[model samples]
Target chain A: QQPVQSPQAVILREGEDAVINCSSSKALYSVHWYRQKHGEAPVFLMILLKGGEQKGHEKISASFNEKKQQSSLYLTASQLSYSGTYFCGTEYNNNDMRFGAGTRLTVKP
Target chain B: EAGVVQSPRYKIIEKKQPVAFWCNPISGHNTLYWYLQNLGQGPELLIRYENEEAVDDSQLPKDRFSAERLKGVDSTLKIQPAELGDSAVYLCASSPGGRWGNEQFFGPGTRLTVL
Candidate 1:
């Protein structure tokens, strides 16, 4: 089943922070995060396994709550380049990774 | 190394017509995936392949959709007698196989518009 993302869209000023959440109905084995800009492919951000581990890449970070079957993407001091759609892909099994509807994040100056 | 490559970046077709999208994954990546993304929504997996073998395709609409990754390399996804509901971005992604959560590198998707 597709995961559900909260706050369908969010607008932020440069240097601000924002959070996007993804929740799955089924138990999650892994959570993968990606960012997609308009007219471009989605770029890999990071992956969190089922251990409730937290990962960070640059100012972008993510946390996976294995028990809750949910994950959250945290963007700190957001930049203009961060304006894009953030997608959370959850894998309940080994190979099938299902994505949420996505949270549109726009960072302005 | 080159990222995943997909082509005919955009396609416009009428209902009942046929269309196909091609993808070349990153070198040595053994797992490839095809996903359909609607406007304002995240991509939904249509199929997954390991090498030349399709390991999962439960979400693919078998009636009019088909995909193949021959020789364990480049792949193609085709839709026959397409319908307007099929309009969306078709994305191809690949990851090095064998890990539980390998990061997938995606190709610039093919935006199909079925009229």
Candidate 2:
């Protein structure tokens, strides 16, 4: 099943921050985060695995809670470049994988 | 390395017509995936290929949708009798191997418009 994302959309000013959460009903082995700009392909941001592993950009980080089957992405001091639609993909082992609807974030100058 | 490649960035077809999208993953990538993205939504997986073998296609509309990854490098997704609802952006992504939740690279995608 697909993961669930909160805050369908968010708008923030430069230097502000935003948080996007993704949760799944089933057990999660890994969570992948991606960002897609207008008229472009989704770019890989980071991948968090079980055991609370977190990996991604310095300014952009995420945490994976294996017990809760959820991952939350934290964008600090948001920049105009960070404006885009963020998607969270969850994996239930190597074969089962799906993505959430996505969170649209707009960082205004 | 060159990123994933896809052909015909956009397509327009009348309802009930046939449409196809193609993708070429990064060289040596062993896993490939096709996903459909409706406007204002995240991509939904349509099929996944481990080499030339399709491993996950449960979400694909098998009745009218088909995909192929011959030679395990490039892939194609075809839809027959497409409906208006089929109008969406088809994205192709690829990963290096079976690494757990490895990062995937994506192609520009083909935006289909069914009128």
Candidate 3:
């Protein structure tokens, strides 16, 4: 089944912070995050593996909770370029990767 | 190294027509995936290929959609008698194998518009 994302949409001013959460009922082996701009393909941001691993890229960071089958992406000091839709894709033991509905983030100057 | 490449960035066709999109994955990546993305939505996997073999395609609409990754390097997705509902962006992604947390690189995608 596909994961669920919270805060369907969010608006932030420059330098603000935001968090997008993803949860799944099934056990997740990994959670992958991507950001997509208008009319473009989704770009890879980070992937969180099992055992509570945290990965960081620039001002974006994410954490995976194996027990809760959930993950959260944190965007710190948001920039206008950070405005995009964020998607979290979950993978189970069977290699079936499912993505959440996505969170639309608009960062205004 | 170049990222995934796709052709025909945008296409407009009438319903019932046939359309095709092409993709070239990054070198040495064994896993390739094709996904469909509607406006304001996340991508949904249509098929996944492990080299020249299609390991998973349960979500593919076989009645109207088909895909092939011959020689395990380049792939193509086709839709016959395309319906208006098929009007969406077709994205291709690839990743290296044998890793529990490998990242998949995505192409710019082909946007299809069926009228």
| Top-scoring candidate (DockQ) | 1
**Which candidate number maximizes TM-score?**
2
lDDT of 2 by residue, B1-115 (tens): 8999998899999999999899999998989999999999999999999999999999999989999999998999999989999999999999887554367899999999999
Better of 1 and 3 by DockQ: 1
Arrange candidates by lDDT, highest first: which order? 2, 3, 1
TM-score of chain B of 3: 0.97
Interface RMSD of 1: 0.8
Candidate 1 clash pair list: none
Per-residue CA lDDT of model 1 for B1-115, tens digit only, reads 9999999899999999999999999999999999999998889999999999999999999999999999999999999989999999999999986654368899999999999
Model 1 over residues A1-109: C-alpha lDDT tens digits?
9899988999999999998999998998899999899888999888888765544476677888887888888889988999999998888887679988888998989
DockQ of each: 0.88, 0.79, 0.76
* Candidate 1, lDDT over the whole model: 0.90
Clash pairs of candidate 2?
A: none
CAPRI class of candidate 1: high
Candidate 3 at residue A20, lDDT?
97
Count of steric clashes across candidates, in order: 0, 0, 0
Off by over 4 Å in 2: B98-101
Provide the overall lDDT of each model, using Cα atoms, as 2-decimal numbers: 0.90, 0.91, 0.91
